[model samples]
Target: MRKLNWILALVLMVPAVVLAAGKTELTWYGHSAFKLTTPSGKVLLIDPWITNPANKNGKEDLAKLDKADLVLITHGHFDHVGNSVEIAKKTGAKLVSTFDLGKALATYGGYPEKQMGFDTQGNFGGELNLLDGEVKITFIPAIHSSTVVAPEGSADKDIHDGGNPGGFVVSVKNGPTIYHTGDTDVFSDMALIAKFDKVDVMLACIGGHFTMGPKRAAEAVRLVHPGMVVPMHYGTFPVLDGTPEAFGTALKKEGAKARLRVMKIGETLTF
Candidate 1:
């Protein structure tokens, strides 16, 4: 039965090989916008402001997104909201956000009311296994403000309170655990994130005037202790003057072990 034993050994190796082949592709679309492609081919967009000032191919890129499974919004700001409403209508992506923000977007903004429900919405300290167990998302607190403004040139120009600001810790099956620190300043409790799960990638905002600057972001990086860090939400306007170089310098000063990954707009990285 030596031949039978050899066949069984080969069969056992197949699953390991398949698991190793699985990869997650992460694409940044300028500012705080990111697209996550899971190993199972599911698509998730976070604050997808694809048409922001930084991306030269913003229009083309936005047009190409035909199949988004989920859209995760960090807060209610215009920049963070970005082109989510348009993308949702185009792809029928379910909105994953706080209950308050979901209501505001559906009421005042253009998010599909039918697609947003209890299956997707959540608040801080809550975790949900989604995408048929391909992903786990947990909401984390962020120190920021959120407001939903009417579209430009609207007659009423009504402003509404969005909800509490927060971030996301997304754990993908057979992939990396990514932390999107949706516009927030450095806080001491950020260290607790690593206590719950190991963060493979951290998408952090480094712009000074609005969110925390480079130095504080570096400290945040140190607290979370992710494998890599990608800076975002900077250089979009004259007020947002934080630079990647400054962030890198501050990271070095903080003695953080995470690798500094500076992504050019529209660039994708596989993990």
Candidate 2:
């Protein structure tokens, strides 16, 4: 009887350990950006452009960052790469950007050039796994531009277009796969991405004047058909004056298959 009791206790402990080792969480930092936390507590930050007037001291927030394992940059734009160098250095996270962007960071931004993990190179349709296959992030296509400016406001000759622009499809360990569309207009290929990746959560950019507005974004959500759709890239600048309320209304009107979710700044979502 004693042996049987001990065996049952071990069995319970095994599942607890597995569950702890298999859990994952995603946090939205707004503007087509997110942080993925693996079950083992490894953190992967995608397009961490976490600074804007709306952030309320968001620049200072970088100093408090901890456990940043990797930093993924969607493009070479200033907003997207705003604090990439600082966060990567402070948290000792690898900077994952295009080969050109990584080189620019090392040459221009004084980042650790050797630590960059170049995933995109002016094209798309590539995937990389991190943390011993605990998570996988795929680089997809976006129809935008890329640029990296030098400290002196001079353009770095080494700067490459790094494709037009892009986003990522992140697959967490035993968790939902999230697709982040980084500053893209509505395109027919979005539907193809949905068919291919089967995204679970989509962090879409809906701020007009640069990215898609509410109407086109609604079409994007419908085409992607994620389990949940969260609007981003709005209320940051005057040009991007879109609101989640408008996006939600459009989603409903369009009869999007996915649920529309609105999150406050610094909020997190778990699957």
Candidate 3:
């Protein structure tokens, strides 16, 4: 009886140990939106453009989220900022963005100014240590214009100009360093970012009309040479018609080291 009891105890303990050692998961919410859950159980949402046509079921999905720890905004575009304030209010998540964006949200968008923290501010080339220990986020340059559009369809450009559109290299505790490139055109700065940050996974935008097309974005991916590449910011509107199939073909032709991962609207990829 003692021998049988010891074997049963060992068998149950093995599954518990494996569950305790949980790996980080990457869930795609579509249209430049992704949720990263670290091993320590911190949730980070990046450029969440929920409610767009590309999202398919974004607005409905937002209501189901009860815990969002940090929200990172690359620019002040309406699509990217969609549901940010609402999500923050609902979940008590901290917003990570430029100083001007935070100010604009508080002054114009009526966000609670009290929850805003000093860690919210990060410029191009700046690094921020997340509240979750050992996870770090570095803001890199993106060659794109960023200005808030008013309800009347007029551009609200200012001297500050909402800083600049950018990307993030997020380093999780025991997981890979994931890079998310916000809306940008092909620029040499991407090469610099690649050299400085050894990205494991890259979320690059590949839409033609507004951002870099398939060909140029493939070049950018080659320059970065991430382990895996995921495409975003396309197929949402009539203007943005670039497809993932084209991107995959180009990547193959270029002999890029990165593997292309084309996810569905609400797919989750565990890293």
Candidate 4:
């Protein structure tokens, strides 16, 4: 009876152990904003535009974000930099960005000066081992414009050079690797991403006008070959008319094998 009880206890613990292992939580706050919680519970915010127009609960979500370990910005666009200053002030999250963009934000964009430094800043083709090696982030290039304009009514309300636009390939220890493609068009170099790492999830922009549309984005997926693709940077305004339906049709036409996971605004998914 004692031996049987011990076996049963071990069986019961298996599920809990598996649940605790290899699990990462991802939350979307509309547009290109995402919150990634690593397996060890370290929180990383990417393009943390928590108050974007697509999210109905933007204010509430922004208020609830009281804990963040890192705040990563892809460029200097107002939409992408949304709420970074506020979140940094509230959570004391360190800024991860290019040296130029970090300096511009700290000097003019109102991000806490102390939160950004060389330890967290890097340029394209550079990989940063952050959070005590819980996450490895590689800076990826994007073909897009970047410029930082100080907040309206601020003393130095002028446009500043924000370095280059880019993306991130975030590899989490014991968890999935994710690629966040910032605003960009289809480029052949995107194929290089798969050569280095196997991406489990891809946060892609499918919006037209400013970024690639569904057709072009599907082509990009074919090049990167991620396990799953999440469409974003769309539907926030009337100008961004790309829809998931179009993206899906384009994916099928492109014969891309990646599974499309379209997340709703304010939705959370665990991987």
Candidate 5:
């Protein structure tokens, strides 16, 4: 009887152990900076411009960050490239980006050359199984321009080619599939993203002037047909005038089925 009771207790605890082992978390640092914590505790930063103007906790967040597995950059824009070098150096985080962008960043953006190599770099339509296969990242194309120039230099200084811009579709094992739009205008091919994998969440750029506005973003959302949408890359500058309220309204008009999740700065959403 005692042995049977112990066996029952162990069986009962198995589900709880599995649940705890599969927890994932996401944290936003305003603008486009986001940190993804996998169930296995691997940290991935997406376009980690932690010091952008919209995030008041930028300095604190950057300083407190201790461990990061991968730092992913969408483009070479100053706003998008924020704090990645600092974070990578401090944490020895490997960089995940396009081969072209990785070369440019290492040569000019001050990224440690050893940290970014072919191991974590890929081009559009390429996929990488990383973090012990706990996360599968697929590169998706984005319509945007990228330029790399020396910071704090004369206006006429040299501008380096930053390569093609793109986004990422991160599929977490036993978790969710997250699609980060990066910075881009809405294009027709977005409809194909959902065909490959059902997008659980989309980190989309709703800001105008540089990227698509709310109306077009809603269209993009409709195309991808994700389970939920999280608006990003808006209101960091005066020119980026897109608003979440407007995005919601547009989504409604476009008949997009995804739910909207407007996260407050420094707040986290767990799954």
Candidate 6:
């Protein structure tokens, strides 16, 4: 009886150990903003527009964000760079972006100069091993434009070149591989992403006018072949009329294999 009891106890403990070791948290704060917490407790914020119009509790959420290890910005647009300076100042988080965009943000956008450096900045076709190899970030190309405008009433309000717009492929140690497709339309080269690493989750923009709509975004899903897909950058303004329901329908029409995950504003999920 003692031998049998010991075996059962070990079997139960195995599952709990595995679950605890592999858990990763993901939070969506509306628009294209996301907070990703790694299994090792590292925090990464991407396009942290925490106060976007789509989020009802944006202010509260922003106030509570006292910890951030890295702030990843994909472009120079006002919407994409939303509240990044404030968050970086408050949390002392390092900035991850292209060199030109980093320079523009620091010089005109009031982002601290000491927080960003070559160690964290890179351009397309380059990859950086960050956080002692806990995370690997690759700069991916995006078919879009980028321009940074200085804050209101600043000494210099001139629009600065924000370098090329791009996305990121973030691989978390012992966690999932997330591909954030910054503001861009469906392009053929996206198929190349799967050749390097299989994408576990894809944060895609589906808003029309500024970015691709439902049908084109579905095509993007087909190209990348992510395990799961999350639609973002929609319904913030009247111009961005894309809907998750429409995106689902388009995914079905395209025969994409990825599971559609439509996260609500200010929702968190563990993987």
Each candidate structure's TM-score, on Cα atoms with residue i matched to residue i, is 0.94, 0.87, 0.87, 0.93, 0.93, 0.92
Q: For candidate 5, lDDT tens digit of each residue in 32-89?
A: 8899999878999999989899998789999999999999999998888888888988
- Lowest lDDT block of 10, candidate 2: 114-123
Best by TM-score: 1
What lDDT score is found at residue 2 in candidate 6? Answer: 100
TM-score of 5: 0.93
Candidate 5: residue 142 Cα off by (Å): 0.5
- Regarding TM-score, does 3 or 6 come out ahead? 6
lDDT by residue (1-271, candidate 1, tens digit) is 9999999999999988987698999999999999999987999999999999988899999999999999999999999999998999999999999999999999888788999999999999999899999999999999999998766666758889899999999999999999999999999999999999999999999999989999999999999999999999999988999999999999999999999999998899998
User: Which pairs clash (backbone N, Cα, C closer than 3 Å) in model 4?
Assistant: none
Could you tell which candidate, 3 or 5, scores higher by lDDT? 5
lDDT of 2 by residue, 203-222 (tens): 88988888899988999898
Q: Candidate 1, 70: how far from true, in Å?
A: 0.3
Give the clashing residue pairs of candidate 5, or none: none
Clashing pairs for predicted structure model 6, backbone only: none
Candidate 4 local Cα displacement, residue 140, angstroms: 0.3
- RMSD to native for every prediction? 2.1, 3.0, 3.8, 3.1, 2.5, 3.5
In angstroms, give how far residue 11 of model 2 lies from its true place: 5.9
How accurate locally, in lDDT, is each candidate? Answer: 0.95, 0.77, 0.81, 0.93, 0.92, 0.94
For candidate 4, lDDT tens digit of each residue in 200-224? 9999999899999999999999999
The TM-score measured for candidate 1 stands at: 0.94
Selected candidate, larger TM-score, 4 vs 5: 5
Candidate 2 deviant stretches above 4 angstroms: 1-22, 118-123, 151-163
